[model samples]
Target: MTRARALDLARILFVLLTLGCAWLGFRGRGDEIADALADTSALGLAAALLVTLLGLALTAILWRRILARLGSPVPERAASAIFFVGQLGKYVPGSVWSFAAQAQLGRRHDVPARRSVTASGLFLLVHTATGAVVGTAAVVTGVLDAGGPRWLWALGLVAGAVVLALPVVRRDVGPAMVLMAGVWLAYGVGVLALLGPARAGLDDLPAIIAAFALSHVAGVLLVIAPAGLGAREGVLIALLEPVVGLDAAIATALLARVVHAAADFAIAGLAALRARRTGVRPSPGLRPADRRTDL
Candidate 1:
């Protein structure tokens, strides 16, 4: 079979697997999930969704910056379309899927294959490193009590950032870092919104944010797990257990997963629709080199 056909098949299977995981995740907690959802304030949920969108938008902006730095400047609308639509590939079983998708979609807009891949790689590396920095800071500052070896984690984050700095210019790093900080902060606020109905106190906000960041980092690192499936929730629950009881933590984690998926799909769909309405089409007769074999 052709590489494109294989990728299509893999995506389909991954979608099915994601659905299966979601079904299994909430199977036994139906009543709790319902209760949690029913109790959640509509305004708060709306705010969470809005914040999620903002975070995603920031990510797209960051990606655009990375692409431009790599000398592949596309229009903002086209960049959004490429970023959001390609982001759907994260649901696939491997981390490379999103990068591959972005490269393919980016080519339609005259972004070279190598540059697209470089931008995607740098985007991910920055995100991961920032997450570690944020997470480790929280842990070392006595925000989250995940016990021992916090210093080691902090050291590791610094080391990783240093390595990533080789490809990123000092000028581009500031804005990208600031944008990513906003992204994670927005996501943390969304998590706070999710936990509000559970009466999780304001005092635990730092821990919650830390857990959210750390769990996300963990999810990204565990590439074999589709969309960081169980890894994120597990890490979240563990980290949050001290602040909120186990049950509340579990409910919050589950709710987060649902909201995240919703946010991703909503943005992708809206971006695609917008691109269609605006008549944004790929450059004629342009084809990207096949990078699927690398995956």
Candidate 2:
């Protein structure tokens, strides 16, 4: 079979797996999930969705900055569509899917394949570094205190600082960091909005934010898990347990997963619509002609 056909099959299987996971996640807590849905305020859901969109917009801006720095700048609209739509590939069982998607989508807008790949790589690096820094600080500052060896957290902080310094050393600083900060902050806000529907208190806001950062970082690093399926929720619940108790933490993680998945699909759908309207055809896989630009 051709690579395109294989990719199509893989995508179908990934979708099935994602749905299966979601179904199992909600199965044991059917009544609780239903109650939460019934009690959810329309306004709260809208607010969460809006915050999610804002976070994605910030992420798009960050990607644009990265591409421009790599000397393969595309228009903002193209960048937004490429980033958001490409994000859908994260649901697949490989970390490289999103990068591959972005590189192919970028080529439609005249970006060289190597530069596109570099931009995606750099974005992930910066994003992961920032999450590490924030997560470590939160833990060290007594926010989520997971009670591991203090030296390990300290080492993580040092490593994060070094990773973060690479971009600054390369003179690709300032706006990228600011935009990434906004992206994470918006994510924190969206999580808080999820908590609102559950009537969870915001007294431990600092811990919650730290948990968000740490769980996300953990998820990203665990590339074997599709979209960090079980890993993210496990880490999130573990971090939140001290502050919210086991049951509430579990509920929060489950609900947050559903909300986050909805947000991702919503943005991806919008981006797909935009790409279609602009007459841009998404490449299913790399062709011989497309592989000329080496990474």
Tens digits of per-residue lDDT, candidate 1, 106-180, equal 877877787788888878888887887777778877788776796786786676578547645454677877898
TM-score of each: 0.84, 0.82
lDDT of 2 by residue, 169-254 (tens): 24655666787778778777766676673545666666777788888889899997767877888999898888767876777777
**Which candidate leads the pack in lDDT?**
1
Give the Cα lDDT of each candidate: 0.77, 0.73
Residue 233 shift from truth in candidate 1, angstroms? 0.6
Q: Under the 3 Å rule for N, CA and C atoms, how many clashes does model 1 have?
A: 0
TM-score of the candidate numbered 2?
Answer: 0.82
lDDT for 102 in candidate 1 is 83
- Find the 10 residues in a row with the least total lDDT in model 2: 286-295
Off by over 4 Å in 2: 1-32, 167-170, 197-203, 278-295
User: What's the CA RMSD for each of the models?
Assistant: 5.2, 5.2
